[model samples]
Target chain A: MAGIQKNISPTHIDILKEVGNIGAGNAATALAQLINKKITMRVPEVNIMSFDEIIDVVGGPENMVAGIYLRFMGGIDGNILFIIPYRNTLNLLDIIFGEKKRDLFCEFDPIERSALAEIGNILAGSYLSAISSLTKMLLKPSVPALAIDMAGAILSVPLTYYGHVGDTALLIDTVFEEGENLIKGHFFLIPDVDGYDNLFLALGGV
Target chain B: MDVVKVGMADLKIVKNPQIITTLGLGSCVGVVLYDPEKKLAGLAHIMLPDSNNSKDNTNKAKFADTAIPYMIDLMLKKGAKKERLISKIAGGAQMFDFKGKSDIMKIGVRNIKAVKENLHKFNINIVAEDVGGNYGRTIEFNTNTGKLTIRSLGKGTKEI
Candidate 1:
């Protein structure tokens, strides 16, 4: 395994944080609109972490989460994941389906699953468009794939891609909130290995 | 009993009453090797199927091809007999799927195949496995009983 390069400059982290800020801001807004509630977010966190450390950010590998995955289709290639805790998933479903009716115990119905996927699509679309405008690059997002599983298992997909190069992942984490509840959703932007170079080059890096 | 944690692209060995574990295994596969007589076990969280494609293959525990041998060598050093070794594996999950995705999206399948092939090369018998699904899993190996317990989100837990 290649040692994780601790070479990401502070400037690069700042730029990535800015990118995350704009993208997640748009996503939070779209979510807020869908639920007809006020949404707030913490300042986006941009950092490079090993796969293990990344798992810790979401409450460890065994913790259950609902993850939304989208592959980037143009100019840049990578995976974008929006993760929400199982409890938060239920909360979002409740808001979308308007209940007391949706049971958290049972499996999500097909309609509920579709609703979740649509929500993921909307958020990813908005986020990508914001970054597209910022970098003057056309970014297309694939239809979202939703997985409800242990955080480690859900993360294995992208980690394997990065494993061919290095074991570290440069990620942008944006935390979302709804009123006092702290909805506990995060958007993780993981650019592919080569996609990092492309991202920096497009962002005025030498 | 002490518990040793094996992170992604990592491996560990433990003895009787102790446990070795790896968490959040989506496309990654976890291979556990146990020697019943010695009461010793080794676990690896293999990230990719092959190390030849990697620029640096120094981390022997990161790929199925390399990790199996590395693990066996460690087990031997810990008094585990190669002849008595048996394996149990878990956690090669697809996680998500979409139409028109490239073959690389099937990394979980590739990883499982690679692990099995490598174990075969080492002549280790695979006694049990819980793999190949669209969900993630966390696995633990109990060195005492050689039980591999698999845990998944909302799917409950099972032991093999």
Candidate 2:
């Protein structure tokens, strides 16, 4: 936490904010195509947070959730998390994929796996694109890892919430709209302060 | 003919004139009990490995741990002989990457284990099975023929 406050945060957060907005749109489009329906997706509200503050803000222990986890590595390294409720996953899927007939012995198998992958690809791709277009910073992404679990189990890694110099945590809140379902996910950017310092120190005569 | 559909944490038993099926089983396990002699077949679309985790302790057909025993008992009560019972199992997928490390979170693997253990406890042998991996499976059982088919989009259909 101390290392985070030692570094400046403004410039980094401004860039992520713009990228997350575009990412939401891309995710919406992918889901639309996957389900073969015309879906309207709304841009999400973006926020930034360190590891600790996020666990507290994303609702308490009572919440049961299922979501997609995608990690960004290469030029930029961070994780993307989605929190979808069980009832909502069905409602949203029903609109996009249509309802499963009770008498039909609904075969919803193959599609579920692909649906998760497609969302990850689109949202993560759009994010990298947005960051490059806005800040001219080149980024690379990896294949996403999707799973369903409690909010606490998903954010397994330890995060430094409060920085040494700054007491506040940065958070980004965003929403995605499609059919009647509204999907929300949080984007957190953690600068390995030492990594950034190494970049600049190596470049400059320090 | 009626097609009986089972939902999450639900179970149904039907014979003759009806066929039973369940879809999109990720970590969930689907257990089928058939009595060829009596022409009675019961299928359980179970969510977890064991019903012990559920709040309802009395209902044995709810979890992977209890559903098999429960189905066999129901069949026995309906004039189905104990020696005539046969078992089949499917579903339990790895869904996510675990950094190539072993973890207890793999529901697909755990489901398979629970079903195998419980079946042994009840002395029911699995006649067929399709389980373990990252892919989701849809299982269909034809009561008329006592045959079950497992389907995955990425892979061709196979009878297990």
TM agreement with the true structure for every prediction: 0.95, 0.50
> For candidate 1, lDDT tens digit of each residue in A56-102?
88888888888888888677888889999988888888787766554
Q: What's the lDDT for residue A77 in model 1?
A: 86
Q: For candidate 2, lDDT tens digit of each residue in A1-206?
A: 34344544555444445555565555556556765656564444434443324545555222334556654544444445565654555555666576654322233465865675566667667655664454445656556666554343344321211221232334444555455444434433333334334323322313
RMSD values, in order shown: 1.7, 14.0
The candidate maximizing lDDT is 1
Top DockQ hit? 1
Where model 1 places Cα greater than 4 Å from the true spot, the runs are A1-7, A101-105
True contacts kept of each: 0.80, 0.07
User: What's model 2's lDDT at A44?
Assistant: 42
Return the lDDT, model 2, position B24: 55
Docking class for model 2 is: incorrect
**What is the C-alpha lDDT profile of model 1 across B7-29, one tens digit per residue?**
99999999988988887788999
Give the alpha-carbon lDDT of every model: 0.86, 0.58
DockQ of each candidate, alpha-carbon based = 0.71, 0.04
Going through the candidates in order, state the TM-score of chain A alone for each one. 0.93, 0.65
